[model samples]
Target: MADLVTPAERRRLYTLLSPAYLWLMVAVFLPLSAMLFFSFLTDMPQDAPDWGVTLGNYAEFLSNPTYGTLMAKSLKLAVTVTLFCILIGYPCALVLAKSIKGRAREALFLMVILPFWSNSLVRIFSWAIVLRGNGVLERAINWVLPFDVRLNLMFTTDAVVIGLVHSYLPYVILTSYLALQAVDDDLIDAARSMGASKLTILRRILLPLSLPGLLAGAVLVFVPVVGSFMEPRILGGRMGTYYGTVIEDQFVAVYNWPLGAALSFILLAVVIVILAAASPVLKRAQT
Candidate 1:
């Protein structure tokens, strides 16, 4: 492909892409480079006269078990939220893609993405209001059921999961819907003509074909949710103290930029490793 492209065409293409590349360099790489540099420092150069490069920040991570515990908690929360999003969002995507049609589908798609319309803080606080003791959810449940139920979900891990899932579910649905939509309806009809059950078709055909999109959505949800502090903080309260919150505290409350940079770099490395490990599966799905 490189050989086939003429020099002028290649130059034109690069020219067209230069702005985006420049933006990435400035917006993403510059900060990351600064953070990587800071990660090895004993103190910010601006703050301390004797500041020097040191491995102590990273060493602390190895020495301290609390970071590991919090990291595990965040990873668990991410996996739980991703799984819930898949289980809920995939079915919704399937229905929108294969069952519904016309304006109804458009309306339903709008509803699926409705969460994005609101500010994230507003959404989290709204959930906080609903999940609190004797809040809307508890009241609704009590009203529907004959027995009295005292349901207080706020400040729990479950509340964090719920908020995260609600926030990220649209990613899964949109990706899955696009994938599902691309499947030729004729293929499904042919399978039906051959006496294939809906379950069989979904398992052997749709699921395999849409695996990439599902994985894309999972990655989208997992990456952000793992690093999430806001939703967890607002919803989980005391229970929300995960690795991300620790990182936030290091940068904000503790004002330990070096340590924070080290922690952030470590997280970036972990996420890179995870994505690298999953690349083969994604490639297989693509094939």
Candidate 2:
């Protein structure tokens, strides 16, 4: 094969790409590099004159079971939120893409994304109001049902899950909607003409084609949820302590920047490993 670009074109390409590469270095890589350096230190250089480089922070992770337990809890929460998002978001996306059209589709999509317009704290607080004992949810249930009941869900794992799902559900819906919309309607029509069942078409055709987008949404949801502390703190109360909360405490309350950096890097490494393991499956879906 002939070379796709001459030297001049190659130079122009690099020239155009240089600004983005530079920005990525400054914005992302530079901070990460600094953190990696910090993670190996005994203490912040400014905090202590006796500070020295050591592997104790990383070693602590291996020696203590608490960190592992919290990490496992975070991963479990991430998985639960991702599954709920897929279950709820995909069907909404499908309906928006295939069932509705024009103004109605626009209105529904606007609703789906409305949460993004509001501050996340506001959203969490709103859920808090509804979930607290004798709150709106409890009142509504009591009003409709014949019996009195306490529906306080505040400060629970379930509340944290609900808040997270509400916050991240749109990622799945938007990605899946785009993927579903790209499918040729003619193919579905042809399947219908051939008397293929809707289940068969969905299972063998639509789902397979949309797997890449679904997985993308799942990844978007999973990565952040694993490190989430705010939603859990507000919603889970004392129950909301996860790996992320500990990391937050280390940085903010404890002022243990070195240990916090180590924990954050450990999280980043685990996330990378998970994505790497899933890459083959994502590639297969694309094919």
lDDT agreement with native, every candidate: 0.94, 0.94
lDDT score of model 1? 0.94
Candidate 2 wrong stretches, greater than 4 Å: 1-4
247-272: candidate 1 lDDT, tens digit per residue: 99989999999999999888888889
Question: Where does candidate 1 have its weakest 10-residue lDDT segment?
Answer: 1-10
The sequence of per-residue lDDT tens digits that candidate 2 reaches over residues 1-287 is: 14646888878888999999999999999999999999999989998999999999999999999999999999999999999999999999889988898999989989999999999999999999999999889999999999889867999999999999999999999999999999888888988999989898888778888888889999999999999999999999989999999999999999999999999999999999999998999999998
